[model samples]
Target: MTFQNEEMRYEQLFRVTAKFHSTMDIDAVLEEVIHTLQDVYPSFSYTLFLAHDNTNHNVIPIKEIQHNVNGENPAVMQAFVTGFVQIEDRIAEKQSVLYAPLKGRQGIYGVLQINAHNAIIFPKSEIQFIELLANTAGNAFENAQLYQQSKQLIADLQLINDTSHRLNSNLRLTETMTFMSSQIKNSFGAMEVGFFMYSKDSLEVLLGSTPFFENGEGEEFVTFSLRKILKEKEPLFISDLHSDATFQNAIYRSMMSVPMVQGNEIIGVAIVLHESPYYFSFDKFKLLQSLIHHSSLAISNSILREELEKLVITDYLTKLYSRNHLEDMVQLSMETDAYGTFILVDIDDFKGINDTYGHQVGDEAIVQIANLIKDNIRDDDIGARWGGEELAIYLPRVDMQTGYAIAERLVERVATYSNPKITISCGIATWNKENKETFQSLFHRADNALYRAKQSGKNQVIASENRVC
Candidate 1:
């Protein structure tokens, strides 16, 4: 080693060092190391290897790193071995080389190999210079890794915050699950992911995986195993299923199943998959856990909100759709396909029944009437108590004729079964292709028809058009 040797490369080394320190992109820094060293010592081909963050389940391979050649050239790579050994591998065949173990003050990150032309003499100062440069490279690599980890931490925190915000704003379980599933899939880079919930009896599984199923994977073994897990009440992970005797035909190979829990009860499980043989790592596991935990909370809150909404929209005494619920459903349904029949009914002399039998028997009659209408109508038909004595029904895809027929049946049933032999008048109005029929107009028309039925005689059904007739 001599001043001439150290000074030979100082000019290019200065530029490369400055670029390395300037860059926060770790990948660029590693490439800069290779490119700069190649300029000074082009005698033998070279390679740079770097890694950090060995304390956790993460691979902190040096960023921005490159070898003059690819991984194929074992002979050239073999030449980079010398007496200095924290690790050993020949760098190139014909040349004596130096392998410097890069480390911060704490511990080793990785080894860097610099191969010169042949057996060349090195003085103390040049050796000292290589040590100093290696120290810098090691430190830069560590700092870059820590910075990246910090960035990822920020992203996770933001995700939690964003999801919490959505819990208040979205109010729909499907939408929230979709957002959450995307976060998990993108965070872990899985080929596929699913969430499945089971009934308390543990016989049925509900697919709430990705909001909606865009693929058939959820309908397959993913659903079956989720049911099994809920029955057993546990968390399970499967590395590869290809070799397994039980589930060989269901999935191709690698998969993971994690229980999604809220409190002591296991509500569901999160299933993740990858095509490769070895994809699950500690980082992957940790990320999956965090994602599932947040998802479970989101899912639970959404469900509770839904139940509250249901409670708000239902009449406790009669179990019919309450006025508030009817309005919401009517508006939403109107916004889409406004084509339907509207039926309005008024209990004939209902004050007489309430005054005679007391409110309890009146309440029971309302419940029975509601039961009759619900039992006869399609699930698409929405039946609601518009107010104390008026009931409204919106029948999707049913015209005025069918609506009047149904109304006649309901009126007759009430007339025959009333405790005091009460009667009712009903009206039906339906939407045609006519451009003039709004939801309000339909309701008004139906109301007028009911008035007609009341005037004609009680216990009769009339269509809006029939009112004028």
Candidate 2:
């Protein structure tokens, strides 16, 4: 309280204020606050209660403000809430506690507590000095936070830019989604990522989704997300899935689901998850929205492209491969495979069915036979509409006996399963690596054998003789 002591305090305050302004680092500012307080008030114990728990200072006595906790110190909370200093005197303990708000122009960030041991009161001048130091620290903290936020914003923009560029590079749907999944996992530290595409009013998990979704463990999450995204048509940021009544036993605590929207429609959803509660910040949720928005158009384009490609090679009525596609498959099989079977199937008396029941019935009979062929063939086999009322099946790596048995099975299935009851004549032709026959030759032989089956019987299978020209 002497004139000399007041001048010295003023000088120290000026020096610390300059130091606080010299760096934008939050840790440095916090350390300076603690050092200055310790140097000036060595007799008093000090603690800094920050609003957020992100800062790290091992030596400084720092704790998070428990705003909602019961039985917390009223003086500290009051100083933080009111942005004013609070003083309490404990007469029985012969001590006084002072709580100073770390107030900047924007708001109060924390409370600075000074416990004066063995004292019932603090001098007015000392309280004023502590208040000044607390105010300086608050301003420095605000500036450091702004600096860090601006840097993060720049990085987020760069991530969105990179993702958008890659997605627009004409990558297929699977490739684009896989790249996006990797980017989100690495950037957000997510434990799992999934991409779901809307198909025929339902959501189908894309290939790039993590194995957690494919293995059926993520069905609940998918169903929940699908319902919410479809109903709300907005992104979801769940801090803790376990807190929800429906997901009481959820393993993932944090979740973010952003709908991939194009124009007015939601094409799909991008979901990110983490095991820790409140793992994703609000800023990250916003960034995810931006990333999905930029990538949605590219994804929509890829889906449309794939659909168009499918239509090009697919038969419209039967959903089988077109004759051109069948030829390509047979040629590729003959070049690479050791042996293969080609079965040319013909509906017996197709003209009679058209005359009796109409052309629509004939088409139905053809579709029934195509479905039977699809059910009986392996996934690698190619089933095609060879022509009107005629279907073809190319089974790669199949030998002569297996091919004849498959043909016989198809002949029986068509006779039994076809509506309006129609039968098919099937001709089987086998080719191996030794027979250097063209696709045309293979087709001619199958067609000849099919003619023989039709002449021999209306509902039977015939295998072509192995005669290489």
Candidate 3:
């Protein structure tokens, strides 16, 4: 009968060993280990502890046990430290304990402990079986850890590649900023995301998912963080803002500020904030650095594109529209208006001013007159530099009387407002359906009128005669 009982025990041990070897999942293996030990010793209490840096007292419990061992058991620590089995049988107290070290070929990983209500001694065969179980479970845990690390690395790489592809898709600057803000907020699970353009002169923020922070107490925290980042010109990761003496008044718990730099000059900052302290990980901070580096190139390109477009349509000296842009505006105005007025202005005796005060002062006089023209026109009206000493204005939906009044006002403003007491000669012409005039015809008539103004007397207004088809 004793031989039969030993055979049955060996069979059970063999089946439990098969369960350990079949799975590489650590949690599943731990569950199987707990059940197998209970089946073998039904009257014994069991506890499984995973090794944390090889310290028995600071181990992580694998499963909840009803028979609670409040602190570190001496026998369990002895077996784990020695990499061997420990047994204590106290027959007088009716208690026994067995400690088996869960060891792999590399090293010991944890401890498997058993407590029997009745004093009992484990045989050589049972001790060997428990050691085999520990070794198998240790290898399974190692495999699981390696798999998790590989998956995380893959995910990080994918995030970087995806952000690079999207940010380089020829978006405008405003659209690019908005897209970057949304991506960061969603990816990091942040409470507020803000993109701010920080330059030597100004601070402008484009906020996303921060309605509560737009004009509230949170705004003070956001402003303070941005100023600090700008001054430092380095990345800032605050795990706890409330505890930081530099920002004691700041209410938010945590934040990250990444400077968007181009060739050592920081043009902007990207900020992410959360309501809890220590919310972001180092891995996430590194990912954000990579993302901002990729986005900076796209943002710089967009800014250059905008500046280039402005140069194409604007006159460099006068800061007014070029002749070609003016012609386009006139054409567009003609298409949609019943009556359109055109005014041509020439700075009177401009060459005499240049000859007397030099070209620099003459330039100042021209700039002053251009300012008067710009100030007198509505936003929808067009102002352009036609040529040297020649400027033009286009006003749509205006009658001849209103057009003449505007031209008169410009002549008075230029003569009264310009330094060195300069004045301008103006000519007015109108286009209407009854006259059936083209833009060139209208411009020619206005030119003729300007010649008349110069001929009659300088600093005066002249209106061309209207001709019907």
1 or 3, greater by TM-score:
1
Write model 2 residue lDDT over 115-196, tens digit each, in one string. Answer: 8888888889888888898998899989988898899999999999999999989999899888988999999999999888
Root-mean-square deviation (CA) per prediction? 7.8, 3.5, 7.5
Candidate 1 residue-wise lDDT, 276-378, digit = tens: 7556765667666776776677787777888788788887766778877776666666667746788887888778888999887777777777777787688
- Candidate 3 residue-wise lDDT, 1-469, digit = tens: 0112666666876786677667765666667777766676777777775564222323234532222334446666677678888888878867767777777766776778877675556667766777776666666666655565577678877776877787788877778777877788878888777766667787666544255555554566657767787677778888888887766765567888788889988887777888788888777888888888888888878778978988999988889889999898888877777888998999999999999999999888877877787888999888899999999999988877898898888888887778998888888899987777789999999999999889887788888873211
Model 3 lDDT-worst window of ten: 59-68
TM-score of each: 0.65, 0.87, 0.64
lDDT of 3 at 105: 61
By lDDT, who's the top model here?
2
Better of 2 and 3 by TM-score: 2
Q: Please estimate how well model 2 matches the true structure, expressed as its whole-model Cα lDDT.
A: 0.87
List candidate 2 segments past 4 Å from native.
1-24, 55-59, 66-71, 199-201, 334-339, 466-469
- The 0-to-1 C-alpha lDDT of every candidate, in the order given, reads 0.66, 0.87, 0.76
Best by TM-score: 2
